[model samples]
Target: MGPSLAAPIEFSATDVNGKVHQLSEERGKWVFINIWATWCPPCRKELPELAAFARAHRNDPIRIWGLSVDTEQSPDEIALFAQSFDLSYPIFKVDPTSLRIFGNIPGIPTTFLINPSGEIVARHVGGVTGADLMRMIQRNQSNK
Candidate 1:
């Protein structure tokens, strides 16, 4: 995972709490955009680590955003999933078509690391660990 990635297409969606969250607001911080679905096993496996990453880097200027791609799942379902992992960050129902904005996401648990300037820096298309995540953040911070 390195630099020279494309800029993410700007988008926003309602968080689990029914509040509108915008991608543009994530500027000036290291943002982790995780594209996932409830039915994906790998996605489920990665949630806890994502949550841990959120907590571990709380003081840092970093944000982890989960984009659930479930077509028919309600906010309650998403809430339950987030609760199961005891997620400290927010989850949003991003439109399936929105994945096109980042290029074709061929798998679940896809993750994109967007720098403070809103440019994507790296991507992981499978399970990831909290340690690995921490390393990515550190790398970004060092680059900045």
Candidate 2:
């Protein structure tokens, strides 16, 4: 967990389907923005966990989005990768070296947990399980 951000982070990226998704638009729900890459083993491993977590919270006030830093792969290839993992959450393609909104990535598989108000409350720097995510959400909720 990290200190609450002073201001809500804002950015928008187009998904594989070409639909633009803005972080600010998800203000009323908890949002998990996962930065990953197709070549990263840990990133590939966490997809199923994230997918399950998304499904489990489908009706809840939570949203999970994946950002793939694979510059070499085409949108169709990326979409296929998501399909291979059964990842139904929105996944976008981004430049790995330039993620200004979330600051320095430091590593792949980094995940940012944004509160309902859009403030970034937690950041995980490695692969995370669905249980780990749920625990973080519960812990943050209890803190409030």
Candidate 3:
């Protein structure tokens, strides 16, 4: 199942670099908001693929943001984790318990795909590959 669209979800969060990123600000592009954790095995495995996907689409109208739901870790710790993976995309530390904007995050490694219009078009509960993401975008684009 996918997100229940109840008017485009909006949120503002500060990334590890102290940069404020808002979902509304990315309205004109495809946005991937991935909720992950530092200790999750699948999250660790998918970081590189998400990073590569972000790099490959750097010039495109696509954006990927990683939200680390590691309540036990500090910002510096999360930053270090991202750095170790060579992840260049924006990473934010968020408390999963307080993240009501996206509804219940049943598990880690959950990814939400938001369309250019700001509506969530898809949601995946496990690790995903770059190819899988691209295919999703392509399919959505074709449907439009």
Candidate 4:
């Protein structure tokens, strides 16, 4: 789903490691933002692929962020979960209200693919494959 954001979605959240990351600071890179939760099955299944997507495209200007929307879990717990899966992307336990920056996220496992220009070009409301991500990012680049 493609919806031109009324304005470039901007957010700043602390990563599990305690480093603050901001969307606006990530200029010139394709920001892959995934809103997930520890208890979400789809999110669990998609984590590895998102990590792989980030690894496979390491040479590209892609920055994948795994934002955990698990209100019940502490950052330490979420970080432990990510560590168990060996997820390589930056992981953060974020507030559910952070979803409003993009739009009304119907549920967990919502992901937004923002292009280098800071425009959200694609979104997936469920589990997504690495191939799907590759194609979409490639197609987005080709269009420009």
The Cα local distance difference test for each model comes to: 0.82, 0.86, 0.87, 0.82
Q: TM-score of predicted model 2? A: 0.92
lDDT of 1 by residue, 12-121 (tens): 78898898888799888888889999899999898888888899988988899899998899988888888888988889877788667666576888888888877777
Candidate 4, residues 1-144, lDDT tens digits: the string is 424553466778899989998888877888888889889999999988988888887888888999898889888999999999888888998878656667667887988888777777777788888987877788788433
Local distance difference test, candidate 4: 0.82
User: 1-144 in candidate 2: lDDT tens per residue?
Assistant: 323376777878899989999988998898999999999999988998999999999999999999999989998899999999989899999876557667757798999888887877888999999999987788788433
Q: Give all TM-scores, in the order shown.
A: 0.87, 0.92, 0.92, 0.90
Cα lDDT, model 3, residue 18:
94
Instruction: Give the range where candidate 2 is weakest over 10 consecutive residues by summed lDDT.
Output: 1-10
**RMSD in angstroms, all models?**
2.9, 2.3, 1.9, 2.2
TM-score of 3: 0.92
Candidate 2 whole-model C-alpha lDDT, 0 to 1 = 0.86
Specify the highest-lDDT model's number: 3
Q: Which is the winner by lDDT between candidate 1 and candidate 4?
A: 4
Which regions of candidate 4 fall more than 4 Å away from where they truly are? 1-6, 142-144
Q: Which ten contiguous residues of candidate 3 have the minimum total lDDT? A: 1-10
Off by over 4 Å in 3: 1-3, 142-144
Clashing pairs in 4: none
Output the better candidate (1/4) by TM-score: 4
Q: Estimate candidate 2's RMSD in Å.
A: 2.3
Query: What are the clashing pairs of model 1?
Result: none
